[model samples]
Target chain A: MPRFTAGDRVTVLDLGKPGHVRIPWFIRHKTGRIERYCGAYPNPEDLAFGRPGLPAIDLYRVHFPQTELWPDYPGPPGDTLEIEVYDHWLEPAEPLT
Target chain B: MTPEPIGYSADAVDPSRLVVEGHEGADYYALMTEAIHKILLEKQVLAPSDTDRVIAALEAPNVTWGARIVAQAWKDPSYKARLLADGSAAAREMGYAIKEAKLVVVENTSSLHNIIVCTLCSCYPRSLLGQPPWWYISKNYRARTVREPRAVLAEFGVAIPPPMEVRVHDSNADMRYLVLPKAPADAAERRFDDLVRIVTRNMMIGTELVEPYRDRG
Candidate 1:
């Protein structure tokens, strides 16, 4: 089962490691809404080193508001950016105070 | 200095003695990959027939088919919805198998604009779209597009109004994406074939818009 579903608010994990992981640095630790659940694929990090990447992981399409992503984002308030993120790097976003 | 050794001018060096060889930029990597391929083949890990099939798939024809899909989407609302919902599946139905690496179609609406870039590397929709433009894979484009997309788009002669939202998608993860630019204002009267003719490679990449077809000929 996937860690998240469409419309779920999640924050990317910020684990620093030396690897061939697909998670980009820009979206690390940032919160976003899962736009949709992209199909699962083999773990690329394990596959990069020629290891057997068994147990495919789910991928998600995540959308983040431009304002939340960049402090000086120079676009309309409605602007949004979307990126694909794997399940392992995503965690449930905390409730708003 | 002794009158420079008679007949010993710099240009007098034997033309045959100098090894003038053109270098391939990817020679080393190509050689390494070839070695790996041969080993895999020897071990029966990858059959030669499989290699041929994969190569054929990579070099498949229909490099400009992306434009055809875009044109069809523009003329058909239901098709466009299916494309946005499942780009890879939509492409497959159009006879292009862009599987494994998923495809996402981002639409450029009236109020929102979308551009794509692979910040870490050039992760483009190669199966359906063919190779990306040289500039799309450049370091400058990748770095600047995510940070200041409007500025980069402006350089490509795509200046968006301040009120319009410019959303940039970084193709850094599993799924690849394509930009579906909104049809030109005068497209209502244009034929489908005419619309396809005006769709340039850059328009699908979101660096430019769909230029309306002008019947000059």
Candidate 2:
């Protein structure tokens, strides 16, 4: 079962990991909504090293507004960037505290 | 005969015209590929005679597989819904089994235009489109397509108006993406074969528009 559902707001975390990570740098720390649960797979970071990477990681398709990602984004307001984000990289957009 | 003016050619001097010649299997990557092939053969991981079959398998699926899926979707709305919901299964329904990654089909609409990219690497829906075109894997195309898609698209003769939302999909994970381009206006009246012809590989890549009558009126 996926931790986040579609439309759930989530923020990507910048763990500053120095390895085969799938998350892109630009989307780090940025908030976006879950477009869909992309199912789970072996952690790429571990897989790169030939590890079994068992207990697959859940992935979600997150959609971020281009304007938020780039303040000076030249495109129209509706422009958006969507990418896959592993579960560990995401936190609830709503403040827990 | 005058010397070619010392420097008649540099990358900046007619940049695209500059050609860097290469031996078929001698480039760094090409050599690396050759080395790996030999290693695999030596290790018994790949049989030397299997090369032809392997290449044939890889080349089997081409743009037509994707175009046929799109054409079917246009003909039957139910298939489109299935494609949007579960791309891999929908593709399998038509015999295009996505062995390596899950296929994710995104649609292009009047308000939203979808473009696919792999910022991390060139992850593509090869099961349907065969090998990705050279530019699809180029670093230049990968970087710019995400940040300034509108401009990059302009390079492909695709100009997305300011009002229409340009949605960029970074296919950086296990899920491969394919853009379900909008059918031409006369798609319904047109024959199925013509409909398939209208949906080009570039259209599925989200860089070009599907012009049904562009080839012939």
Candidate 3:
């Protein structure tokens, strides 16, 4: 079962480890909503090195408002960027006011 | 001052001619792909037929069938609902051979506009849309679209003004996506066939919008 459901808030974590990672730097340390759970899959970081990655991790599409991600974001607050984030990269975030 | 040599103009040797022929932008990645393929073949990890089959899949005629789905969704509300609920299943039911990646179909509305990009690399819905265009894989597009989509869409000749929100999908992992462009407001005035014909590949990729269909007759 996934930890977060659609509409839940999440903060993409910046683990700071160096290696193959699916999460982009732009999305790191950002708050977003769970768009949808994309099902579980072997950690790509492990798969990159030919490891078995036996235990799969859940992946969810997180939607972040452009204004929060960028300081000078010119678009409307509704403008969002959605990306797939693994369970490990996401943590529960407090609801935004 | 001496006159120019026989049949020779001063611009004949214009520094441009010295530029090497056939080596313009990116040859390194091509070399890297060939090297990796060679190793895979040597290790027996990839069969020659496998490469051929993959190439065939990429070049197949049924590649850009997103328009078909778009057209069907426009005509049938039920189908559209099914597509939104499970895009991969709906596309597969329609006969699109989805590879390992799943498809997520996003629709455009008067209040929202969607654009697609892969910030880390070029991951596209090739099974449904054939191959992504050159710009789709270019480093500039991969880097810029998620940063400022409206400006990028404008560069792609689309203008999203006011209350209309721009949503960018980063197709970076596991899932591929297709944009279901909203039909024109005057769609009822046009024939279904022409509208389908104009549903276009770029519109499905979210870079362009379908123009109002006009009768040729």
Candidate 4:
């Protein structure tokens, strides 16, 4: 079972599938602050196979800036993106350089 | 930019044949099969296997259909009220079913704007609006839409004026959402289909709002 909570910083782990993974391509390898804790839900990987009992994973709503995720994101400087991610996909954000 | 080819299976009802608008997704075969099996088990159908090809054809994106509904609501006040009251019934009024999908309609008020996201996974309203966009399901949009919807909208070329509120609607559970954008000015007389043409999928998702074309050309 995955264990993470709101306010915890995490990095998305790349699963290597281009379109299949729930994590968006733009935010891979980046880190952000967790904004909310969406309770455990069915892991999508299990649902696609019509299987059941796959342990529910805790979901964290993470916030990141558009500029941080994209090199040429044409938006205001303060603009940011927040997404909900499963625990398995995230590791604690590495210390700031 | 060359648009991606529209994927459709043979034998599915032609989109034009249906009074409703929009194409379903290509992967609908699996879900349709499951639906048919349930129907057959209930003695509603004589030959479950007969629907094999139909199931395949049922696949198409649902955004176009969603756009149509938005346009219709914009043109008709009563319809709009019904939609805000009960989205599923309103969709059924237009001959669509919620079917294995939950429906939620987020109204955009003068001060507040609403956007939808599936943070954990891409649990979209596939039955009503078809497949979600590649970006919508992307971790970036999902993660950001909730916490920073205004910023996401800015990236999408939408800027909420100061003092305007931005409310992000997270569709994480069984309930899926559609944004009821504030109708643009001077759009009171446009036909439903024509109005739909102006309501892009991004607009339905709340990243953008429909605007009048400065020129037809």
Give the winner by TM-score: 2
DockQ of each candidate, alpha-carbon based: 0.22, 0.31, 0.25, 0.12
Docking class of 2: acceptable
RMSD to the true structure for each prediction, in A, is 12.5, 8.9, 11.7, 12.7
> Candidate 3 residues B1-217, lDDT tens each?
9996552222232422332323355689889999999999999999999999978977883533777788778877898999989899998777876785888999998778888898776788876777778888776787778878888888988877656788999998889898989887766677767667878778988889875223232
- Output the number of the DockQ-best candidate: 2
TM-score of each: 0.80, 0.86, 0.82, 0.53
Worst 10 residues of 3 chain A by lDDT: A16-25
Per-residue lDDT value at B108 in model 1: 84
- Candidates 1 and 4: which is better by DockQ? 1
C-alpha positional error of residue A84 in candidate 3 after TM-score superposition, expressed in Å: 0.9
Q: Per-residue lDDT tens digits of candidate 1, residues A24-93? A: 6667778999998887888888898998887888888899987787778776677778888888888889
List candidate 1 stretches off by more than 4 Å.
Answer: A95-97, B1-27, B34-56, B61-63, B211-217
Q: Candidate 2, TM-score vs. the true structure?
A: 0.86
Docking class of 3: acceptable
Residue by residue across A1-97, what tens digits does model 2's lDDT show? 6889999999998876767888877787789999998888989989999998879999999999998887888788899999999999999999643
lDDT for each residue of candidate 3 in A52-94, tens digit (9 for 90 to 100): 7669999899998998888788777878889999999888998
Candidate 1: tens digits of C-alpha lDDT, residues B144-203: 787678889889888777667778888887888888988988776889989888888788
* lDDT of every model, 2 decimals: 0.79, 0.85, 0.81, 0.68
How do these models rank on TM-score, best leading? 2, 3, 1, 4
